[model samples]
Target: MIENLWKNIKKKEFSSIYLLYGSEAFLINETKQLVIQEAVDLDEEDFNLSSYDLEETAIEVALEDAETIPFLGERKVVLLHNPFFLTSEKTKSKVEHNVKKLEAYIKEPSPYTILVFVGNYEKLDERKKITKELKKNASILEAKKLTETELKNWMRQRASYNRVEMDEAALETMLQLAGTNLFLLTSEVDKMALYVQDSKLITKEIVEELVAKSLEQNIFSLVDKIITRKIDEALRIYYDLLKQNEEPLKILAIITNQFRLIYQVKGLAKTGYGQQQIASVLKVHPFRVKLAAGQAQKFTEEQLMKCISLFAEADYQMKTGGLPKNMIIEMILFQLNHDLRK
Candidate 1:
């Protein structure tokens, strides 16, 4: 997709029709708008511009509207957003009726009319017959979630493109702390870029102080204590996070997710699965999974199961409001670590 995206964006070779679907609606919509603005002008909108919401209108009505020629122009453009209306079961009759009509029209679509479809936030089922037909007949771009490492690498490229310089460590720290919320991450990076206008290099201090849950130090400290079975030290770190307004449920959730990954690595290593298979299943980089799998071999399955169940109980208690949240978690840390040590 990356290689194709590069070649597809060159205007001279661009496809006239496009179906853009994805979770990242903001970026997708921007790309759609750019295509439209380049295709027509504001003064020509009366003859050229038409937009519809699928929830409100039928496919036949949109097709009829699109096929109508301008009273006074050379070209027409139809913009359909959330055309899921075209695919509804209740509207299936109408959709089939219109799709055939559309295919007929598409075969000899207007030299003056450009049809563009947008489903900004949700995806159209690519596995469906209609989706395949659309793909074969027109251009399609599916914007989806970037992998963790891809997002991290992208941050560096994005910062460079935005005329910002970020230290490699600071960039990596943001990736670990922030996961993959591109909108928020881009905003934070942009703000830091502007703040460091004179200095030119965005430092770790700037990022740590500004970004929420800058976990470079705190997480390392927490991970260290947990790994070494230092219950008291881990408790202090956990409580520090709590006092700073981190939710108890979120902490339990993150640790639980981490443990599950470790569990998978352990199981795969025991069975002699290679690093690539483990990474794909875990959705982590092969090297990281390999390193974790090697480290996982050092811990007994008993320790892994003990940590998992402890977190699970902590989660259950928090969700049910069954006990004093902090105390329950604090006790869990001690009992589990104490058991591991003995």
Candidate 2:
């Protein structure tokens, strides 16, 4: 796990070569910073740290830097960024890279240098000789997206790091409000920790009061309130969105998408598909799938299908010359509320 990697870094356990590749930018950047902090001191950073853009600079240039002796420092850190050549991606750079130099350097890496390759790729071409050689020789770290449980645990750990305590329900509410965006959620967590300073415990009330909901989250809440027969509150949220100048048709489209997700998750669950599995099938984030699954449980398939049909009609009415967009959405919500009661 990443925690183990951090622990090792703290103990000064250094790897000569590290290949960090992934789709998630946050985890990849964070891991890189951690390694740099451990490998190079503040004073030595000027002379000891070197960064190269593989697109602009040849691979041989970075490898040469890696092989050079450190200047006034015990160790050096060479950062090779955007190694697109490792994958099957067509090279857009005019500069030519010597793959043989890279392979040779990997075979005999500098004892005094920490050579790090930052590949912001989902998956590298495994068939390449250089890719295979690097994997065979380097310590690899994958920066993949986290699952729902992992995301929640990350929130708890981050809260603990900031000396704040978050209850489980509070954490869940925060996640719902922020969705699965780690960067946005991290920023929110920092603000929340400061909001409850000295008090130190984050409550569901604190989350509701302070955490800003994304538009998607607000729509989810509106749908939840409508499904549970809180018609007045649901209408209030919709009105507030209109007050903020959000387009009525865009709002309706998102609501339609949400309903579609609920229907899909419900069907997948019936077939013994787990939340993560369903997310994979739908090509969406697992956190979204998990939230939709919860909402799906409150709705029967017939009711969900009816809501979808209502959404389709509302969309058409908005696009064509039927009612005003706001009125159409309002009428749809009112009708949905009436149907739910039946």
| Top-TM-score candidate index | 2
Please write out the lDDT profile of model 2 over residues 159-247, one tens digit for every residue: 99999989999888988899888898888888999999989998999999999989999999999998789999999999999988999
Q: In candidate 1, residue 85 scores what lDDT?
A: 34
| Superposed model 2: Cα runs more than 4 Å off | 43-47, 88-96, 300-303, 309-328, 338-342
Q: Which whole-number lDDT from 0 to 100 does residue 277 have in model 2?
A: 89
The collision pairs in model 1 are none
* Local distance difference test scores for all models: 0.68, 0.90
Poorest 10 consecutive residues of model 1 by lDDT? 88-97
For each candidate, give its TM-score against the true structure: 0.73, 0.86
Pairs that collide, model 2:
none
User: Candidate 2, which ten residues in sequence have the lowest lDDT sum?
Assistant: 1-10
Clashes of each: 0, 0
